[model samples]
Target: MNTKLKAMVVDDHPIHQTIIKQYLANKGVNATTFGNVTEALRSLQGNTYNIIFCDLQMPGKDGIDMMLLLNKHGYSGSVVFVSAMDDTIISSLTCMCRPFTFNVIGKLAKPYFEDDIDKLIACVCDKHQSKASFQKQIEVDEREFLVALAEGRVKNYYQPIVDTKSGVLVGYEALARWMHPIYGLLLPYVFLPIVEKCGLSPELFDTVFSNAIQDIKLHGIKHSISLNVAQDNLEDALFSDRFLARCSENNIDPKTFTIEITERESYSSNVNLYKNLLKLRLNGVSVSIDDFGTGSSSLEKLSQLPFNELKIDRSFIQGITTEQKDKNIVRSICGLAKSLNISIVAEGVEDEETFSLLEEYGINLAQGYFIDKPMPLEAITVLNKEKKYV
Candidate 1:
């Protein structure tokens, strides 16, 4: 509410205009009224509004017309369409906004009440955030990355993974982050490939492995912890011996750890690769195939390897609530994993609706932003105390 909302009301009817303008005025919103999309676009030329209250049924350049050109005119603010537009047409039009990189924040029919307008206003308020700090550019070179890693700037941040049915915390996936002193937080995709290309993947894994052990012991993290392994870590002949040696030194149960192998990275047919995987399994560490539906070799990889878990990628999980195709894909994956006697996890579950559908789909575990964002071990309060997420 403190964002200082500015709105553009596009409507042709004089009475509706007066009513909407009055409502906005009451709410302390600075609103500019336009009788048509043509006038609205003219106002948007060099000016920007936080949101636009657009009418659907207009003479030329209706709601659809305005939306199609909004991004082209450099208007990145959110939009709310007003009219008695059919739900079917609305669904179809919603797809168009994605390409324009703007969101249809809300919809209202004709003859709506003040409460409905207030609801849309609530949506706008919910989307606002505190003033953003200046973001430094993320560009990085190899030597700088190596220096950062050497300084122990690349560390593990854990995100919670919960049991879907009980909504109880079951585990956490240890993800890597570059806590660069100057560059801030740099994600894996930025530096991981560089590390792998420079044949430093095992070194990076050593850092993560050491950090996970230290965090679990220091934080008293009792839940399962999953760590992602690079392809090189598997290909190395001594990875298994070194890994088991560390686990023995720490005196932690191997069952407490899960190794996540992305679908694309497991193509190596090294004897050491197969040996390491088998040795880890024999020692009681669970192995999971991450990003289930994303790879071309998903089924073949599952068949070849002795995987204990299958993780449905977020790309598919996020769409199940709205896309029938995604729902069907997840259902098939769940059935396949069940048949294989394997547990399933749906990651990237950001909302309650998605999580509920995943639970209904028989997902054994779920993880993503909705459950929790990855953070330092100290920030995960449930690690120290039992907590229910649902």
Candidate 2:
């Protein structure tokens, strides 16, 4: 009946710490305050708090350092960063924490209002409720991922990519899902870094590719199936040959498939990667630039690489409905792709408004929850049979 939340506040400034503690107290949260990162981290070793409020500008150890240490210590609670820093710096630090596996709840800039603190507390509490669902995902490691790959537990879930104007299912993007014995269904983010680190990406890709081919054949679907390929896969000398051979054995048309290369990974100067991609294109397999606008030097890569499709990143697409800047960015990207004679696919089109905006921008394709969440092969087969996906 208490309904009290456990929280920790780490700040060198006594006044700010008191402010945060008082703010959290008002929200029915019992908060423990610390004046230094050392004491805070030591408390973390023995105590489990639902949320941690970290100050970015602290003496001895800053918030970023504490965040890295939190990951090192395997702290899995939500972290809220409090700083007077610029929005850009806060955004960058928040982004950095995510890759380290920290659950960044929200940020409180300096000169904070009481409403801001209230919002932060509410957000933290809301996120904490869902923490249990993700706790099992945290237990996954490279060994588990390797076992899953070897046991043929990696499965493909297909999300249909539709033509924007016609609303016709044009293709399906193969997303990897691991059928973990204990965890049930695990998304790619849960184990992909480990797969890449353990050099098992190619194996994982092969598993997904084989399943996708079968799914296409089983359903007698004629549309293309796009598979995400890593930089290492492209760098492999025999990758092209192996891929083409698999398609040949499966009796799949290379034209009915696409290889998606993410822009986040650097492939600008990889001669071998370029050669392999060129080989795929020559053999009728199209290449698409995935998450188009988020990466550095995207335009440069676009001009240099022989990609036929440009996927507008989800970040921009998700914002188009509410943010003017996002709309402008999506429009510009669509224009650029059109000028180059490249087809554009906007990812994360989650609403009718966003979909209409994308259509207005002349985006060639769209894919997201608005159309359909990724489905298992059986569901896809049903949809194909019913022809209801349009």
Candidate 3:
């Protein structure tokens, strides 16, 4: 017999509790119900769960608090947020709480039917398997020489952002990964911060840009290639000139490649940074404000710089369907971009609903797991050969 899917369902309402219990029971899940955070924590003390289906708004402690509690207990189960609150707010909350969160499997809107619950459970199961495999891969990677390999372990993964309505691939983002001989592949989180701490960020940036440029030329990719540059690298005259010269020497049009600076640094205290940016822009390189709206000075930077694109961060885009406030924020950004004639790309479209919502809201460009995950440059070459996106 298949083991029942174990879950903890938390909500203050008795009817909602009954509904979830009946729903889970129909799905062959063994669910424990809790009307409050204290009871939920108490239940957690005695047993482990495979999933937690929690309401966003409860009487006290709330959904966010419950997430923190789960993290504090080291409960590595999946979290499925099921709430009536706006999806955007829930999505935003999820992002805010992600650093301490363990395993968030799904986000289901409230007033959900049995079909929704079943689909969510199925999704969670699929995600659980992928996460397990991914974590195992990371573990094997942890045993390898990530530190030593960081020196020569430059890799680039191309993730496509297509026009939703036209389905045309307009651009690709360059993602970094570290491949170890023994441990397989180490993700950016494993070695990127370490590289920065070890004072190799500039070198790493060189490798990423060089490989990205080469890939663009090798695969005959004509669309814009987005590469992230560290704040420290932006101030280096030698680094910037070398980058420009590489593009010139390779005949790779600087206009087709965008150098992205995170929103945090785009609003830097250094007044001269704008001059550096201006110089690059004058040479055909486009600048982009990455992860817009996470920090202050978004309006200031947007007005001050000649940025060609504004990327709405995934945190805000993840749940715009349900959250009215989130929708408004996205709408505001889209409207602002339209007024400014700046191209907008919504990052992190993980589901069909989110993708559709962005398109409905007039966001043409999108990149995330729903379209594709970041993969090795070799895979991207295959995609190029396949001509999946023209």
Candidate 4:
């Protein structure tokens, strides 16, 4: 059995290439090294690689220059940058590769040690190994999604959010869980587009939302609850009406529920979206803009819309403890949210250090694995009763 994963390293410097090859070798991967992208391109004619370490500065044909040609050559393997460049700039370049169909995994800044490169190699290997397991995506048709929705196979799990200063459980975010009997839980990324394409987002939303609030009411759960609002449902003229009716039916206050907008495109020219959002606001339901700093028009959206809460995305939160740039951005966002009188919630709060920093910065609410993972309603109801979360 030939179990070789073809790998390549493209660096202008011979020493850098040697170090990377050694790292790959440590992972039991014998990598072919190229002094420049030109040679790498020439080799691509005869052989395909499973992973490539590319450098941005290589005389004439740099990594950016290789993007189009690589795609033209149908190179679909994962690529990581081994360049003497700032990680931020490298990240932007990686995004640029998506347009050209490049499978960029990540980057190793200048002076990266063996551990850095080894991590990338391990990622490619693990991804290849796990594609047939948990990472496996089963495509269920629109009809099956409808059947699942009708059969109540779509479940709701709530992740607890806490008040940063008081350490009191303030709310829970209702994450939709569609459990397939054989494959188990299908993440939203796997199942949602199909639901949207099948024009069944509204139905799915109602199923999840109705179940969540009904559970909350039955258990006398006092914490506020958040629902990730899909644009399709938000655009419906009857959205706010139906949402409010459901709350009323459950004898739950609209003020206890929040609708979160996650997508950058949620800030659209669509009038119905705005109208429904306004109606929700008028009824005392809060609206939060999730992943606040990710989009180009985030500030403009803040000025143009009615948002009661701003959620700082996890990308910024993850590094606040170690990265000064992350701290600076988090501080600025907190200040801006304060000035606008909008409460700020920090998502992806995974440690005590980050949570303390967020509290010091006056973040109102925080949630992540540090606090708790999303769990079934029965589990959270027990916590609510015992006040264990506080």
Alpha-carbon RMSD to native, per candidate: 5.1, 4.8, 3.4, 3.6
Of the candidates shown, which would achieve the greatest TM-score relative to the real structure? 3
Clashes of 3: 5
lDDT of 1 by residue, 264-333 (tens): 5647567887899999999998999998887788988788787999899887898788656678889999
Poorest lDDT segment (10 consecutive residues) of candidate 2: 129-138
Displacement of residue 199 (Cα, Å) in model 2 is 4.2
lDDT of 2 by residue, 142-213 (tens): 887888778888899999999888898888999999887787888887887888788887888889888888
TM-score, model 1 to reference: 0.70
lDDT of 3: 0.78
Candidate 2's C-alpha runs over 4 A off are 1-4, 9-28, 32-46, 54-75, 82-86, 109-127, 133-152, 163-168, 189-199, 236-251, 268-272, 293-300, 313-335, 347-364, 368-372, 383-390
Please, what is the whole-model Cα lDDT of each candidate in the order they appear? Answer: 0.83, 0.84, 0.78, 0.83
- Decoy 2 TM-score against native: 0.73
Can you give the lDDT of residue 26 in candidate 3?
85
Clashing pairs in 4: none
Which candidate number maximizes lDDT? 2
Model 4: residue 123 alpha-carbon error in angstroms: 4.5
